[model samples]
Target: MSEGTGAVTNAGEGEEVLQPFSVTIGATVPTGFEHTAAEEVKEKIGAEASISKDRGRIYFEITTDNLPKVHHLKSVDNLFVVVKCYDNYQFKDTKEDALLDLQEIAPVLPWSNALEVWKLNNSVKKKRSRRRGAAPKPKPSGDDSEGEKLQAETSMSEETEEQGEVCPEQDMSLQREQNSETIENKPLKFRVTCNRAGDKHSFTSNDAARDFGGAVQEFFQWKADMTKFDVEVLLNIHNNEVVIGIALTEESLHRRNITHFGPTTLRSTLAYGMLRLSKPQISDVIVDPMCGTGAIPLEGVIEWSHSFFLSGDNHDMAVSRTVNNINHIVKRRQTGGSTSPGLPIDTVQWDLCHLPMRTSSVDIITTDMPFGKRMGSKKKNWDLYPSCLREMARVCRPSTGRAVLLTQDKKCFQKALLRMSGLWRKTHTVWVNVGGLHAGVFVLLRTGAIFGSTPENKRESQKASETQVEDMMENI
Candidate 1:
C-alpha cells in the first residue's frame, strides 16, 4: 500500500501505504485543556479525523503525508509507544524506531508527534550541556610568597593602565559589560512545562540549576533528583504549535485526552501497581467492584490475553458510560477485521456494600474508592465506604486473591478493615497525586476468616483465633 520504497516528504495525494504516521496523545485538564494539546500536535503534522476520549485514551488518526516532517522532530534516545497491537486488544509496548514501524501499525498514531517533540527537548538539552568548575585552576608555578605579591602588583598595574585610558563614562560602560558577561557565564536552567493547554513552547529559567529548581518548585513539585527527566515540561508540539504540561509522566499522558476518557489500562500509576504484584496466571480474572467510570476494570481487561474482567458500580450514569466504553473498545478492535479478545471485559451494576456474588469467587480486587470531598456524595460516601470494603472481604477468595484500593481517607478504610474481623490484610502503600489531590493506595488481602476457613470445623476454630487477635490489638 506504500507509494514507494523511498521515504516520502509531504503527505501529498498519493495512494501509498509506505509512508509513516504517528498518533499524539494528551492527558486530563480543565474544560478547555485539549485545544492546546491538539493544536500542538497538529502544528507538527496533518491530521484526518480526531477521536476524542474514545476509550479513556484520547486518539487521533493522522495521514502518512506528515511522516518526514514528524520524524525529523525525534531526538530522544529510546522512544517507544504504548499500544494494543493487532494480535491483542490490550495496551502493549512498541518501539517507534523507524517509519515502517509507524506505517505498519498506522491505525494507532503517536499522540501528535510525542516522540518528535520529546526529541526536540533532547536537542535543547544537548545544546545546554555546559560543564562547570572553573576549568582547572592553573597550577601555581614554583614561586615563593614574595613572588605571588609581585605578580599581584603587576596585575594591578595593568588594570590601572587600562582604567586610566578610559573616561569615567566609558569605565562604567565597561564595568556593565563585564557584569553582563558574568551573568551570561552563569548557568541558565530554564524550566517550562511544554504540554499545558495553548502554551506549548514557552519556557522560563534562572541563571543556575539550584535557583531554577527553587523557582519551579511549585510548578514541578520536584521531590527528588532533578535529572532523569525526558522533557522537563512535556512538549506536545506538532506542526509548530505547542502545549505545556508539567511533571509529565505516562499517567499524565493518558489523562491528557480532552475529548475522551483515559486508557483503561497501561497507564503509569495502575500499571506500576499491577506489575508490582508479579502474579502468574493464564489470563487472571480481575474484578473492580465500585468500578466508577470503568478505568481500572477496562485497563485490566486490556492488559493481558484470555483475561476475564468483571466491573460493577452503584451509579447508573457510570454504568452507562462504561457500557458505551466497552462497545467503543470492541468496535475499535473490529475496525481492521481483526478478531482477538486479548482482554475481554464484563460489566454489571452491583453495589459494593452487598456484592451479588459468592465467596472465593474473584481473584484480584483493585479500585479507587470514592473519596468524599472529591468524588462521592457525603452521606453515601460515609455509609458506602466501610460497607463496600466489608463486601470486598466477603466475596474475595481466601489467601488466593489480593485487593489494592486507593483512597484519600486511610483512617476510615482502616477502621473498616479492623471491624471486619481482619478479613483483609494490608500489603503495600503507594502515594499518588490524582488531579493535584494527595491519596494513598492500600493493598489488602482477603484472609481465610472472611471467605470461610479450609475445613468446616477448622473454619470456626480459625474464626475464634482471628477474633481473639483482633480483640487484643484493639485493646492495646
Candidate 2:
C-alpha cells in the first residue's frame, strides 16, 4: 500500500483477494437526517445499517448484498454499492498525482484485465507453438463446450455493442448474469460518476476522476478484442480522501414518478424524514393542511396502510395537483405497485388557520409550511405561522397529539411557537437539507389546556371584536 496515495497493491508472494460477492452496499441520505434515515434502514430495511455522515450526505451500510432490495427505500436519497474507500489519503495536490492516486485506488478489473493479460501471453505462446508445429487442443462439445459459451457471450456482447452505450435493458440483464455466475468473466457495460466536494483545488476533481475513468477504460480494452460493461463507478472526493461506490439506481429515488408537477411540492425524501420524526401511529388521524402536492400524505399512504390521511391546500392549483397525484398514487398501488393498500384518502380545500375538523380530533399533523420564497412571504409568515400553529393545536388530540412542521423560516416559526407556548410543547427540532435549502422540522406536542387570553391578547381581541361590531352596524 502507498502511504501518500493510500493505494493497495497486489501481493508479491502470498495474498488474499477480495471476493466480488462480498461487496458493501449503502444508502445516501439527506444532510442533517442521518440518524432518522439510519433508523428507518434498520427498522424497514432490517439490515443493521452502519452510518457515515458528511456535510450534505450520509452513507449507510447494510449486511445484505442485495442492492435492488434497498434501492427503493423511501427515506434514502440515493443508493450505491461502496466500491472502495481510501482512508486518510494524502492527496499530492497536482492533477497528475491525483489522477495517479485515483487510478491506484480504483477497483481492479479482475475478470477483464487478468484475462487480457493471459490472452496476450497465449498469443505469443501460439506463435511459438506454430513455429514448433503444435496446435491448441480442441474443447469438447458437450454441455460445457467452449463453443456454446463463446457464442452466448458473443451474442450478448453484440447486442450491447449495437445499443452503442448505456443500455438499461442490457445492463439489468448483465447484472443478473454477473451475480449468478461465480466464474471469472468480463463485466457487461459500465460508466463513471464522480463527485468532488472541496474548495481551492489544484485541478478540477471531475477532470481527475474522468482521467482515471478513461485510464480504466483503456486498461480493460488493452489486449481484449471486445469489452462491454456498463458499471456506473462513483467517486466522492473530499477531505483528502476518495470514497468510491457503484450507483445502484440509475435515477435518484427522490424523484418520485407519481408526482408529475408541483412548483413548491416538498421532496419525497424530506417528507419521509418529517413523517418518521413525528412517529405517527396507525390509529392516528394525519393531516397536511398545506399539502401543496400531497407528497407528505402520499408517503404516509405508501408507508402505513391503516393510517387515515386528510390533506388539503387553500390554493385551487395546489389542491388540483394534490388530488391528481393522490389518485395516481392510489392507482399505482392498486396496479401491483410496491406500495401497500392504504385506506381511502380525503382531500379538502380549506385554510390551514381555520380547518373544518373539530377540535381535539386529529392525532397527528404533518405539513410543509410555506418558506416565504416561492409560496408565501416572510412578512405574512409572522401571522400565518402563529395562526396555523394555533389551529393545529386546536385540532390536535392535545397531550398525545403531535405536529411535525417543515419550514425554512426557523426564526419566524420559533417566534410563533413561543407566542403560543401554552398551546403546545416543543418536542424536537431538526435541521435538514431539502435539495439545498437549510430547513427545520419542528415536532410539537399539543397541550390540551386552552389558556385564557393574556392582557395583550385581550386588547388585540377587543380591538378586532369592536371593529367587527362596527362593520356589522354600518352594514345594517
Candidate 3:
C-alpha cells in the first residue's frame, strides 16, 4: 500500500490496485461520552483518537482494510471519512467573500482517495443490508431503461457543447461521438450537507452548501440530488475549525440493537457507554431494576456475553416490550444459524422498591430512572428515588458491586444519595445530553456496610408499604 494514497501495486502484473489506503475517520458520539468513545476506539481499532471535547466527536486514522472494525464500535452514532481538516480556518469578513473562498477550494482539495473509500463503503452497506433481510433492488423496466438512455445522450450533448464552444462544427460532432461511447457510465448523484457553528460566521449552513455544492457539481459533472443521492458530502464548520468529509453511515449506529419500541426507549449507543462505565466482569450478574425497554441489558449481553443480565421494570408494558425486544434478537440469531440462539438475558416485571432476588446476589446494577418529564413526576421522585436506591443496595454485593444510574433529576438524585450514603458512595459522574435535556450518569459503588445494618436502610424499610403502593399508582 502507498503511504498516503490508498493504492497498492500488484507484483506479478505490475498493475496499480486500489485497496487499503489510509484515511482519517470521524465519529459522532453521545455528548459527554466523548472520552469513553475514544477509549473504545483505541481499544478496538488500535488507533489513538483525538476527542473534539464537548462536541461529541472524535477523529482517528485507519487503513481502509480496518473499516469493518469501525462499524462494530458501540459508542459512535455516525461515521464519516475525513477528506480535509483545517484547524485554524480564516473566514472572510463578508458572507460573499467567504462563500467565494469555499467555492474556489472545491476542485483543488483532494477527492480521489475519499471517493474511493466511499465506493467501498457502499458495498459494505449493501452486504449488511442483505444480512438484515433487505429486499434486492428492482431492475428497471424496458421503458425506464430507454428513458435513461435518452437522458445519458442529453447529458453527453451538453458536455460536448460546453467543450466545443469555440471550435468548428466538425469538432463539436467529433466530441459528441466520443462521449456517446461511454453513455453507460452514469454520473454519481450527490448532496452536500453543511453544519456550521460560530457567532462570527456570516453565512448559514444552507448558503455555504449551495455555493460550495454548485462548484463541486461544475467540477465533477455529478448530479445534485437532495434526497436520493448516492454520496453525502459533509461540510462541518465550528468557529475557526473546518472539516470536509464523506458520510460512511446512512443511519445512526444507535439503531442497530433494538427492534421493539417503547415510549421512552434509550439509544443503544448511550446504553453501551453506561455499561462501559460500570466495567462488567466475567460471570458478573448485572441487573437493571428499571429497564424501560431493556436497552441496557440487551447491550450488555451482546457486548459482554460472558456476563449475565437481568432486566425488570415495574410497568407491565415496559416488561412486555423488553421481552419482545429480547425475543426479536434471539430470533435474528437463530435465523443466522446459531446452534444456541439464546442470549444471556432475561426480563421480569417487578417493583423497583422490592426486587425479587436474594440480598447481595447481583454484581452490578445499572438503570435509567424516570426523569419526571415523561415517565414520572418530580413530586413522586422524592419517595421513589430513596426507596429504589435502598432496594438496589440490598440486592447488590457490598464493596464489589457498582451502579450506573442516569437521571435528569440531578437535584433529586443527589438528595436521595445523601440519604443513602451508608449503602452507596458516589465515585464518578458523567454529565450527558438526552434529547436536549442535560442529565447525569452517576457511578456509585456499594459501601462495605451491610444492607439492614445502616440507619438509612432501616429508615427506608420502615416506610409504609401502603404509601409506596400509592406512590406507584400516582406514577402510573
lDDT of 1 by residue, 133-218 (tens): 12222231122111001000110012100000000111111111122212124432333222112222122111112232333433
* Candidate 2 lDDT by residue in tens digits, 142-258: 121000000001211222111110111111112321122222464435555556666745656557656666666676542222333344455676666567665544344554633
Per-residue alpha-carbon lDDT of candidate 3 for residues 1-476, written as tens digits (9 for 90 to 100): 12258555674656444556688988878888899998999999899999862287799999877777787788887788888888888999999999999999999988888876676665555445545666333221111100001000111112100000000112111111122212137787877877666799998777888888888889989888776666777788889889888888765666566666666778878899999999999999999999977889999998999999999998988898789788877977887788988898988898887788999999999998999887789999998998888889999999999999999999999999999999999999999888778899999999999888867566666664567688899999
CA RMSD of each candidate after superposition: 24.0, 14.5, 11.3
Give the worst 10-residue stretch by lDDT in candidate 3. 160-169
Error of 3 at 165 (Å): 45
- The full ranking of all candidates by TM-score, starting with the best, is 3, 2, 1
After superposition, candidate 2 runs with Cα above 4 Å error? 1-21, 60-68, 107-189, 222-229, 337-342, 451-476
Clashing residue pair totals per candidate (backbone < 3 A):
48, 10, 1
Choose 2 or 3, whichever is better by TM-score.
Answer: 3
TM-score of 1: 0.45
TM-score of each: 0.45, 0.74, 0.86
CA lDDT, candidate 1, residue 343 = 40
